[model samples]
Target: MIARRPEGADMEAKLFGSRLSPFVEKVARALQLKGIAFTLVPPKSPADFKRWNAQTRKMPVVEIDGRRVFDSTLILRRLDQLVPEPPLLDRDAGIAARQRFLEDWSDESLYWYAMALRWSDANAEATTTQVLGSIPAPAALRPVLRVVLRRQLRNQALAQGLARLPLETVVDELGRRFDELLVWLGDRPYFFADRPSVADLALFGQLNVLQSGPTPQAERLVAERPRLADYFLRVDAATAERRAEPGRGAARGVDFGTTARGA
Candidate 1:
């Protein structure tokens, strides 16, 4: 069940997750789109995994007014309620349902394709090295940790079925998905309208990984579809501008505060 916001507490929000996670990006993008301020709290250690969300050890979990909310979809829904001015979902029930369906497919299905490419043998070495190197770990421990984590991630993907598929198969399927997106998007700035909706944010989450993550396959595949690349760029630029607006107080909203060291 979704948690309801409590009254009479500080309204400031804090997000706990890594930028590498597309799920986390979804929540962050929502905050920017809504003009709501939030602090980012990336996990710094293994123990940090369970800090924000004990049940899932997952991220994009949000703490607002002293209440903890997990899952990007739920987080976005909660934020929509707190600051409803710019609606992220359509008021029309049919449109809203379509948006929700797309978001779910992106999160549950498209995400695995991105993960498969990211942790595949061809990309694993370079990807893990860079990803682990960015963490605040001792240099000596980083190399060994990187190998261990990469294996674990790759195993998880294999067990999930995507990683077991041949890389060629994964790439071909991803290409087809991109083609579908091109047709749906056409000249529209977003999936359904000029302004981004929840579906757009959810789709962008995985696409962000493809564009910026360590996997070369994603970058190459995206390059083949110029329209998709342009759309992703547009979304990135538009949302980033929200944080840089003159009176938005971007720094304050994104301030690290003191919780960063712990997680």
Candidate 2:
């Protein structure tokens, strides 16, 4: 069983999530940006699954001061409310709306593209091998487990239209959207404002996943938009610093290293 710090104990927060999920990363980045103390508990088994579902019925559940917060967007808003100094949401209504639109697009629209990529035959096989290799399952059972996982993933892909759509079509769509984002940003350092806002955090988390992977278009976009890439790096470093501090508050950062398997 994964060890959980006492909920609502002092200033510490605990997050249950998978590393590969951009939504989880969004919440983690927000906590890091705000210098909040938290523990990252990776759910590695069916038992861990039950524990997480009992709390929020979803992954990326945030336990702050013993209160549980679910949904990545809501978590960002909560962080903004908690730390008003550096607001993640813009003050202007129009800009905030635009920012939110982009964030929503990333979460709802772009997510399918990522799903398509992850569930591709080659990617699925690679991920299955990686996941099974990490667990302590008996060597004899590994192949059986792998087949089950692959079939399950295939079912999911079909349900999500991932298996039906051509990868090129998905990639082209993503590339086009990314190009639009670049053009929209123009010369600005961030998406909608001079400072990094919730919108920036949301989009950055999603795009960062792509950039870190084998997506050539994602890499090109990052290279073209160096400022955005730099922004992500800064956020990551800040998050690490906040998590590395001493005492209860020091526990705020989620260690991506430990949860890297989810990625």
Candidate 3:
């Protein structure tokens, strides 16, 4: 449940998650776009999985004004209600509908494709290594964590149905999704609007993962489309700190003076 906001008061937000998660990336970019300053906290140990977010036991959980928000989609929706400027959705009904659809597609469908690629036989080892490298854990724990983490992720993909397909089939189908996006984007600077919407942020998160190591094939596939590449740069620039506009009021709601730090 979301905490009630003090009317017209400044608030602060604490986002507990690793940047490796596209969902986390999407929320981080959304906060940046809204000019909400937040710390990008990486889980210090395996236990943080349940502690940080007991509901889903997932990263990307956010805390503000005694409110804890789980799930990226809900966070974005709550953000739009709290901070109205540079809205995440267009004012036009038709435009907003399309933007919402694209955002959902990015999170639900595109995410699984990337996950399948990550846990595929070819990239699985590299992906495991990267996951271990990103974790802030004790040196002694790395060995055990590697085996456990790999199994958990691979199992997730396997159950999701995409990972069960042949590697070549997954790659080809993913490329086709990119083609569909190009058709949807057409010549627009942003999806359904001149400014970056939740859709753009969502797409950016998935694309960023594709380009960032562990999936060279996915990276190359993204690079194959120059327009899509430019979209990446544009989205990155728009939500970056330099482009972030100071919120009209504030997000200094959370008092992190005594929050735990594993590092």
In terms of TM-score, the best-performing candidate is 3
Candidate 1 has an lDDT of: 0.75
Q: lDDT of model 1 at residue 36?
A: 63
- RMSD of every prediction: 6.4, 6.2, 6.7
The 10-residue segment with the lowest total lDDT in model 3: 254-263
Tens digits of per-residue lDDT, candidate 2, 1-263, equal 96444322245578887655678777776766666667777656535655766754566788775577778988777766666645777889999898889888888777667667666764676557655644556788777888886787667667877457777777677677767877877776677787777777677667656654534554665667666566566545543434343345465444544332223
Best candidate (score: lDDT): 3
Clashes of 3: 6
lDDT of 3 by residue, 115-198 (tens): 999999999999998778777688998989999999999999999899999999999999999988989888998997899998
Per-candidate TM-score against the hidden true structure = 0.87, 0.79, 0.88
**Relative to the unseen true structure, what is the C-alpha lDDT of residue 221 in candidate 2, on a scale of 0 to 100?**
56
TM-score of 1: 0.87
Per-candidate Cα lDDT values, in order, are: 0.75, 0.65, 0.80
Assess candidate 2 and give its lDDT.
Answer: 0.65
Candidate 2 regions exceeding 4 Å error are: 1-10, 54-56, 130-144, 212-240, 243-249, 256-263
CA displacement after TM-score superposition, residue 33 of candidate 1 (Å) = 0.8
